[model samples]
Target: MKVSVLVITYNHSRFIAQAIESVLMQKVNFEYEIVVGEDCSTDDTRKILIDYQQKYADKIRLLLPEKNLGMHRNFVNTLQACCGEYVAILEGDDYWIAEDKLQKQVDFLDKNLEFTICFHNVIIFHEDNQYQPYLFLHNQPPVSYIEDLLIRNFISTPSVMYRAGLVDNIPNWFYEQGMGDWIFHILNAQYGKIGYIDKVMSAYRIHAEGVWSSKNRDWQLNKTIKMLDTVKSNLDGQYEEIIDRAIQFYSQHLLKLNSIHQGTTSKFTTNLPKHLELKDINFIVFPDWNQEEEHLYQNLYCLVRLLLTHPENNRIALFIDTTKISEEDANLCISSILSNLISEEQLEKNKNINVFLVGKLDQIQWRTLTSFLKARIVLDSENSDALLTSGTEIIPAYTVNQLIEFGLIFIGSAKPYKLNIGCGNVRFDGWINIDIEQNYKTVDLVCDARQKLPFDDNSCELIYNEHFLEHLTLKEGLFFLKECYRILKPEGILRIAMPSLEYVVQKYMSDDWRNQEWLKYPEYQFIKTRAEMLNISMRWWGHQWLYDTEELYRRLTESGYINIQEFAWGKSNTPELRNRETRVDSILICESQVLK
Candidate 1:
């Protein structure tokens, strides 16, 4: 056999058949075999495996252990049974989607003999929750070395395909490893370079019974400690520093756990030092500063110093002379200074600490400040009591609002402009992901897509919205589409992926519709007749409007879009677009361009 697909199972009865069927459906010119280790399953997984083995006798080799060998032993024993040049791994709960998945990987490895391993992306689906399924290896680099594996395990189990015969004998440490896949990738990387394909061709299911699923923070830390220990042993002090840092990183989690367990206890709440006074920075300068504002700015110096006792205060007062600097120029200066102080990496690391913009505020400038610095606009007088309680700082700046806006412009221009509207935890790498909900880490901007986009006209080069348009009413969707057109550049690309009404209707009316396993989805479980099912499919999942191909095309055209083209699932004329996972039969993907 040219390739051997290894599947290790224990009690994955419900999902085992799907995994086997996925392997059987591989479209490849070269011969391949499926090696399954049942490991004496208590569920019907063994029966399902036996049925598959009996049916595809010539292509399948079964390993039925007399007793449970656990995951590691079963994996090693099953891997030993593989007789192919290349070995692919897929746990019993995960399944491949693309028929050409094996073909693609084998072709890459066959051409590039220097590469010992290849991997693609896989969608991670939560079996019991409403969490949206997302790609696992979406942001990983295309190539990795042994040192890369030492840093972190970018490889997932189902997405991996490595050269066989690399491991003559499984080490005793392999059985003791916390995550088998991590060690497996490290072993393969020792031989040759690792390759990556960007396509999402497989899926990993996360359920309660899975070993790593539903793990607490402490349990996850323990697993990390184990993996780091195993890795440190293999590497000859090459990554000792990072490993030490990682150990320390996990060690710090103990303090975080304690803090969470106990109530909100400020480290600086008791007898704290007063905030520094701003001698030269006395008055707040804005477009309009009345007598009320004058009174506020006169006492700003002392008031800010008194509020610096609390530990939660991250407020900084700016003392910029707006009389000498224009609003636009002030924005740039403030942005440059803030960019120097807080890097993107730093912002990501310190998420809980709010940077308060405590200075002069222009109507337009304050909005820009909030957008770029992600700072809260605060007045020393308005928040006198709260600032004293939270330990606010009064730093000096010349112009507040204008400086903030300038910084936003500078940062926004520096980054490649791609927008993901209504991005619900499915983040696209190098894109400004926006959603209605805010998780700070994943979402860059939190705004309703139905409203005007929080971007300048003709600013974005590419915009993507998956299954988001259907959640808006017909009028709302049209307005949203128009907004998309407005934000996209003259030659910008817009891709909309949503449920296809026509496909749902056709599938509902088909004779084999009831026989379809997908119809057993919770949304359609109670519905009996074809019409009822179709109606529910259209209305459920917070859907406000559904569209067919023709309707979608019409909407795009009405929104001043041109060069509208239809695309199949996982197929797009635009490069870097087709690699995204698709919903297949139930979804429609259409692309439109602003051709001026």
Candidate 2:
């Protein structure tokens, strides 16, 4: 195999030798030469390149630009000057991970002439080697995506080795101010399927100037717009996916960064676009806004903030200017998204908990009827200001050094109240005995409730829960309600089960159980169903929303029942239920006063 290596440098005087040496030490059975482009570096970079040229004149082609030609131009000119059957790229600060990196790639492409570009994963590291980005330990994918690249960019530039004459000429846009070799990869992948060698090929140095290491706080993003624009400006529609992926790559990167810096609350804002893709949310309600001038994004931001603050896994009805997208088109988009979001295997309508999302104010009548009927309780998931007023409170009467037990912990188990929540030891006894993985506990029957009879309304009269719902997704929550309604008989009841919104707002606003370690357990799949069922009203999140004793009573009456009663535990300690002679926050149920 005959190959040419291109090493582009800006101000990499100190690290250039190490990069060059890696190429020199390659054990390839081929004729190869090194081409170094010292882009006008206002440092000792050029001098070092010429000095290396004098020593290894036969093996090296040093191009010293009279003045800095910038990275894009320098790379293009450097490649044009090199004459080799196959060309491999390397940057200044990075070095080969294995001397065989090139030979393996070259041999594969040489034999399979059908191949144009082949790349591999790089072990990224800091200058000090203190923190390595690529965890050979974690072991992620070796080589990946090029398609829908407007969606992602996994192949690094320095990791590529393409057959000569892959393109007629270097695209002019690469020399543009903000463009780089990624653009070239996009162009290359547009023509051929990307090939991979599942081994570390290079040590990608990640310093401040590293493409992905630096931090950018803006997480809500769309990359397709920029790519489409770029494609329109330079390459024509042929590179549409490339541009689109660039946008998605940036947006996804921002999402990850926000998760790192902003916490779970920010996810709602970041994932709104993703949620809008949900197929279940029909008739999206935008309470107020002119979507005509990017105001929709602003409105969404506000609503997402509200949803994050409360436990009610509810949606805010932000108003969008109907002129932007017709109701039919908008509904189609949201419904399709919801459909894609929830799989048939995991979703069961009219079972467990189901949330009905309405879009326009015209739908408020239906909402009111549904709310009056299904809303055993409805507090804005975001309205934490008046949270946990469930008329339950308790004191730390005594101290103990033991871990809390599930059965004995609930305070409402006394005379005035009884609740039927939590996996009954009687029914799930088999589950309790099962190990975390040996049984595949939850993913099978234990995890799902299909054959589990779901719930029986009067089974237990109240619910006592805490930090659990965020595990199962929104679809799972809907199923929980279906079970809730099915289980309840005429006057049967449910006590609130879960962490208080006030508690979450003040101390756990950004808390979510999805990312917890428990999710790795076999029971987590089943337990997560419980987590999704728990929600906060004001924040419109995991717990859904907080409930009041009276609202609970009202919902029963509205749902074709009679003789209802409720109590409020406003602004009081939770353990000691306000009216209950115990130390807990809970609600009681009686015959519904009104019958629907």
Candidate 3:
């Protein structure tokens, strides 16, 4: 074959037909075949390519892999399968505007022996119409060298045609990079000078699905720096100066982006087109007309203070005009302000404090913000000035229960409540279920119990947990027991169930129990030896420390609990705590009472 056109596609069902038709319309004198590598698209791209292949069997060929090989591997495998002396590149999302695009590049390379690769300028078409279409490059020279290409990638993939064997010895480092086209151009340009044809032959489409165009500015710059580092390392330092200059350029830009996102510099306000408004917020240290750095800081401080002081059930909506500032920067600024203005104890006390960051307001966003303000208004309509004021007396006990039922107030119930700590999927009625992971719908409070529990002193009536203590280390378990003791009222009950060390050792020592039903459990079935069984029991399922009866009793006693007692499975003297154990076999159960 005189020339081969390489097209690699995945999930490009909408544009693959136009790409294929453009290749078939090429007016060339010599033989050319369309070699498409369809990497297991989850869309109709494969079916469409199949229909085209059946219609044009002699001119088009398809390499359909059974599974999805990612872009890098698919490009490498498809490039190797090309049989032509010269190869032209095109992506499934792009197409040729000029019918004689292939003929022009082929003629340029066929006549010029010194030029190993030939390319031309193409139209940069924005598929989303977010930007106007324009030419890819301007003021193009007739010839360029490797040093000129190393500074940046000026070649558009769909506009290039190169000698097939020039890139035969592909570098090992090429496979490690996330992108392929730029490095491929560099590799092919190493053999000879790059020839340029000043013509717009194809339209390079930019859309949400386009691989490189879809990434954010930060990701693109970071990837460019990483690729340049790889090139500098593998090329034996021949272009070290140019590559170092490019790395420095990208690194400086990356630092600026990070500073902006972190809100570390005061110059960010100058970049804003208009003064950002912190709407309906009080405690302004400076006048609203001033847009100084101190004004921004004071507003942020008051915002954090407002969020911290409000009642947990009250939804206080604070809207900021984020036309110039990104939502990410807004969130970071709030976090920075909170860390600077509030004490850690204040944050710990307000564990349920929530501050939501939103972008520039649209119709839906405006409605959501208004709804939050309306809810807060309905809750505090009688005494609007009482909001965000600390040290207010709690409501009378008679009305507290009624207010809690409506989800309007949470002042630590008048009656002592129960706790189901580390309650993963197995929840008890009338108890507040707490777990670190919120994957289960049963979890009512999703804070780490290792930290201070979000309950007041001498507040809880009963605390129960099962199959959870073993997941914590001996130190964490002891601290958690103390936290429970601190929160439980006098004569309050604390119950725990966990894997027993004695049971695991006894089962491992006994040879006859290897085929027991518990051993047939899915996680234990893979154990072929008794030692493996022991390891799986102690080390699996994130188990850090397993306790025997004596160790658990000693830890509870150390944590200031009296009346420590052992109980059988599903057995508890307290009615609410009874029958809460989920695992029946090879477990230890214990209960204790706190006496002040």
Candidate 4:
């Protein structure tokens, strides 16, 4: 199949070199034609494309738009101009990192007749082109079903290769609204499967200039809301689920845009997402300075109010240099009324709303030196009280252990010798709450469960912990479990929610490992380090045990814990919790009893 590489640009003279170089570098079995639509760039961006066309006439075709067609209109027009069976797009600001990005995509499309579109994971680089692991780390999996695509767009324009025929039926109204790309894919998926390559094959540059830049986030999000409505309206009975989910996502994104637009001062008004998670950054009341040029100080004052004291804005993370802040400054932020993000009214109004202050990133040295030293940013935030109280109670509530529905009743312990080691923050509403830390107000016992079971044999109905067991020393933890056997009813069960190591590696460590970069430099070979195959095995999250759901079954069964069934869930925090004390949120239910 003849693949048409549609390259569009407004003014990307500096980055075009890398973009063109990538196309020329492809070593594929089939030939691909490169057609570039230069949108009459006032700068030398057009001149660069002209030179590339002249040099590679056989491989490259350059189309000069008489005047600027703008971003959305430019790409849709390029489709009509380019003549090829297959279509792939590469915007000027972003470029392919992989030489085989096109070839691999084409090959996948060629072999998989059912699949019409293909995309791979992209690595997001800084404007200076620094290798940022955080972007890749957060990037979701490449291969997704139609259901996954509906939640949000995974394929960036630069990373996608689609069938040319699919676009012929698409109208200009989709593009005119500025969110043509999303509609393009949703339409294609209806015809067949969409393939994804699980590698970082493209470089996505994020800065002030691009259309989807953080500054233009409002335009993109607002446009996205419009597109979602269009998709929701067109949903046939079969596509209803995706469309419904899209509506929910549309509302969430709209609310996020609202939060971002109102200068981060306002509490989230739109009641959507059941559990809204904001990791760590505090900048509310940031005005749309780009839109309001005439009202500069008004925007500036709004930004200052947002920075200093903005009511209703809940900062999930505040990335500040703690060295520049004092106890007085801290008190202003903590006690400020405007900093009143999740009020009592807001909590009853919505569900599980969280705000935080994350203070670490590349080279933007946090004003405070000690900001990087905290063990767990999520647990250390002003809203930690809220996380513990997320589904249980409303705010002004500080204790995690004081919930009425802490009703995760375990029927029995696996073995009389089996010990319940580390119980994160999940306390039994009726049982003893034990931990070595004096800090947690609900801790019933201050001794480490890894060393011994403080209780006698055959006591606990069940040995249960949410996402907490993986953090203990394996040798000590194993011994502790053996002791739990000494205190369990014969018909007992060990209900544990340990970390799925595979899930963690894929989520944080695999292709990009930037989990811990605040205190030290990001060490490369990221996946292996996070897996802790070498010394990572020694102490991970201050833990000594690693298990997927499979190993948990083997370890407990070997220790004489009968009816030992293991359940796994995902947890995302620096402390990396797995069992009790931590709130485990998953829909999967596991019920078992110790062999009577």
Candidate 5:
């Protein structure tokens, strides 16, 4: 045989068929066979492999082990079975995108006898995420030597094609190494230089079940350290410095394992805008002001002194000139102070701290101001006189400071709260899990999401729901959004994950379903015809309404939200909301703010 594709699989029932079909689809002039080593998978992987072998009886061979042989043993046994001029490695979860992938590599290897291995670029796509696909070793040079292979395993497994007879009996250490692909590449590199094709011909799938993909950085680092140690012993300390440097870098990475902020003490320094800066203290009153304007500056200075004394206290001084300044100007100034002076984190923390010093304000003014700003009022007192001494009356204003302190009865303390609505089985840390079904003990509140939430108005800091919005009808969805807006505090975030109408429509209409590369996967074959695909798009999983970006944006805007931003699947500004389990290509994420 000219080429033998060595495919190693274990419990990869969902992906094995695609791997086999990719080989079957290859446009090779010479004969090639696929050698799949089924390591006695507990899943339907073995059955799937057997079916593929029957379908491609002449071209496919299976090493069906009675018991689990483990990854290292299975890989070694699989490699030994390939009796071809050249062999390519493709893990069950990975697939070749290019039909001429093998032909191109074989031609290159046939001409370049000095090269021990031939590899090309591979697209590394996350199985559970819609993140933009990235090329593996995108910047690596076209030609790589043994020294390059030693430093990094730049060649992805699916992209590699090496001389078949180059490797006979796999080393004992290879069985013990955490990353078998690294050792395999290193072994081939020892014979001659490694060749690289610049074009992307394959895709490497990263999912929860992946060997190195699922492992934490600490585990991966430890594995790397062990592999490097083994390499050092095998090579007689030839590449000591490079290996040592890598070990050192990874060892330091262990210190950063607990990346979550435990006790972050970020100091806040408020920088006033250039326009707000006192150029002679006359800017506040603007034009050539008389007595009232002059006195206003004196009161402002006193207020500034008081604020300086208690900088930590949440105090807001609103100097409103009903006659002099327009409402737009007043809004701009307030917006500037809040936006420039306060950070989002700080704002969330101090949302309930009501300490406002209002000047020249009526009931209408107070209503307008309070509607926008949720802060306490600072009343005139003996301390206020102490600063002003010869004060000519601090602008005729009414202070509801005492009333707010005594009358306003809050249902709960202003402790920031997060809510997960329609939370079927999933639970978020430090969040109230609400669901219609109370099957799980994690569910804190049980209620239908279509109705009003049990949460108090302007109480929740964040509300997130994945794959829940589409279940509601247009009217119900609008009501749900309104409810979310009502419960969320000013500047509270509402993150929603829903099925993408655009993605589904495109998938149904496109001829991508016809291609072998696309048809090889089961994810695309759920619906047979275009009508079924379209019907499934709307009716699947008891969906009432499906929305694209534009529709979703309109609904959110109508429900009184601002700062709306769309995120790719499994992506959000909020780290806690970035859950891969709730992600897919058909899933679209959106987040907006209940701007006060």
Candidate 6:
């Protein structure tokens, strides 16, 4: 055969027909065949290819796989199946516009003995947006080397035709990388120079499903850098300077992109809101003038109390200047603030509270830094009392000290509450159900129970968690127990129900392991042997630490609990905490109390 047009498609039912027709319309004098590797697509793309194969039986050869081989495997297998001396690529989502696209590329490679690959410019069409179509490349050189290609992949896949058998042994690393066309071009270009036809012959479509075009900017850049690093290592520094330059260029851009995404204003400045209205009270906590770490914690604690007390539509914004500290320190500070003051559950449910990190406070126009928050007042340390600004709309600003004083006066009036931490879909009628994820409908408050509980000391009447303690590590579990102890009032009960390690061991020793109903869940369906079941139980469901009655008693005692007791499944002495357990198999239940 003179040429073989290679087309690999998956889930491109809408555009497969056009791609097939483009190859058929090519006016060539030599014998050519269209080779299509149709991976198992969930859509009708395979059906379309089968119909085309039947109609053009002699001209088209379809290699349909029973299962999806993914893009890289399909491309490699299809490329190896080409019997012609030259191969032309046309992806299912793209098509050639010119009838003589293949003929011109074939003629050029045939005459130019030194050139192994040839390509032309293509019109890029954005299918999902209103962007006008443009050429993929401009002012193209007639001939290019591997060094020029190393800078970037400027060649469009649909417009490429290369001499077959140039890349006989594909590299194993090529399959691991996200890019295919660029690596293939690099492999082929190593044998000879790349010839550019300079004519716009094909149309490259960019849609939501297009693999390379669908990825975000950061992913694309990072993937490119990874690909280049692999090339650099595989080639053994054959083109180190060129590849290093390319890697550096992509790495710098990636850093800047990440900085911008993290709300860093080092490279660019963001405009502050001129005015905002709040339905309830708005508290804007300014940075400590002295930048004292202790003072920052005090302010955050005050804000957390304010949020818990008012549970109405109250808003609080805390500003942190990150320019004074390194990025790592800034991140540590933010994590400390969140893990100590507000849980992720609180941040998700109460969207009113915000923490803003500014790269430089001097760059902002407003005296206070507020972004994407609706607030009507500013709370600063300098302002002792509410100060009304002389403007079109007078906004009130209060000091943190005054807020603390106000909190001290009203904090005692708040009612005591019961908590159900890590409550996954098992909610109590009169208790506040809390979990890390907000997707659970029964979760009343979305916050991490592993973090500090958002409540006043000795204000909780009861605390309960079932099958949730094992999910935390030993250290984390201990810390969480102490948090529970701190929040519960004197003589307040704390109950915990979780999987019993002793029960699992007993089941493993006995012959009734296969009869356990809990192993039948879909997650444990892979357990075919007794050893697998025993191993999976300890590691599955994000389980970090398992406990028995003895270990449970020790843990509670370490967390400063008194009068620890063991109970049966769904059995608690306290009336409010009774019948709360849902799982009964291999379960261990324990209860303790906090005494001052």
Best by lDDT: 6
Candidate 2 clash total? 114
Ordering by lDDT: 6, 3, 1, 5, 4, 2
How far does residue 494 in candidate 6 sit from its true spot (Å)? 69
**How many clashes (backbone N, Cα, C below 3 Å) per candidate?**
15, 114, 0, 76, 4, 2
Tens-place lDDT per residue, model 1, 1-596, is 89999999988999999999989999999999999989998889999888889999999999998999989999999999999999999999989888999999999999999999999988777786335455686568888897777656778889899999997877788888768888888877889999999987888888888887667655665677677777777677877756654443343333233233454223212221122122211223222222254464443332233222222233333332243335575455445444543462244334322222234333223222222223223443243333222221121222333322332222312222678788886776557778876543456566778788767787778888888888899999999999988878888989988878887878787976676545644323456788876766666557888899999999899999999988777788778677564454337888899976
**How many angstroms is residue 58 displaced in model 3 relative to the true structure, after the best TM-score fit?**
0.7
Greater lDDT among 4 and 6 belongs to 6
Better of 1 and 3 by lDDT: 3
Please report, in order, the local distance difference test score of every candidate based on alpha carbons.
Answer: 0.67, 0.47, 0.71, 0.54, 0.67, 0.73
Tens-digit lDDT track for model 4 on 1-596?
37999988887887888888978888888878998888988889888888888899998888887878887677767878777878988888878767778888888888888888888777665673222333342445545667667767877778888887874656546665666677788878777777877776777777667766645544665677667666766665666545544554444334433442455423332221322234323221212223333353333323223323322234322222222235365335543433343352343334323333322222111111111111122111233322222211110121112211221111112223323334434454445455554223244344666666656556555665544556666776677667666666777555665445555555454455444332132223334444454344334334457666566666677667665443444322212223333433231223245553
Collision pairs in model 6: 345-446, 345-447
Candidate ordering by TM-score (highest first)? 1, 5, 4, 2, 6, 3
- Per residue, candidate 2 scores C-alpha lDDT tens digits across 1-596 of 28899899877777888888888889988789999888888788788888888999989998887887777788888888778888899989877757888899988887766557887777655654332133232233443455544444566766889777677676565555344666777666656666777776677776765533442335113233344356546765655544433443344334333333445434334323322222111112222222343444433333333322322223222222233345786555445533433453344333222223333222212222221111112212211211112110110111111101211121112222233233322122111111111121111112243223323334433332222332234455445444544545434443333324443233333455344432443222334333342332233322343434444444444444444443343222333323321223222322222111
**Alpha-carbon runs more than 4 Å astray in model 1:** 216-218, 242-596
List where candidate 3 sits over 4 angstroms from the true fold. Answer: 263-596
Q: lDDT (0-100) at residue 64 of candidate 1?
A: 96
User: What does candidate 3's lDDT look like per residue over 1-596, in tens digits?
Assistant: 99999999999999999999989998989999999999999999999999999999998889988888889889988999999999999999998878898889888888998998999988785675433356779898999999888877889999999999977767778888867999999888889999999988888888899889889766887798889889888888899867765664454345344433555333323332242322222111111212454656664565456445555424333333334455676667777776764574355544544455434443323322232221221110112222212101111111223323322223223447688888877776557777775422365555688889877788788999887788788889999999999999999999998879998899889986485556653323346898887876776557788999989999999999999999898888888877888775537999999999
Q: Decide which is better by lDDT, 2 or 4.
A: 4
Q: Please state the error at residue 349 of candidate 2 in Å.
A: 30
Off by over 4 Å in 5: 129-132, 259-596
Lowest summed-lDDT stretch of 10 residues in model 6?
385-394
Using TM-score, give the best candidate's number.
1
Consecutive 10-residue window with the lowest summed lDDT within model 2: 390-399
Query: Any residue pairs clashing in model 3, and if so which?
Result: none
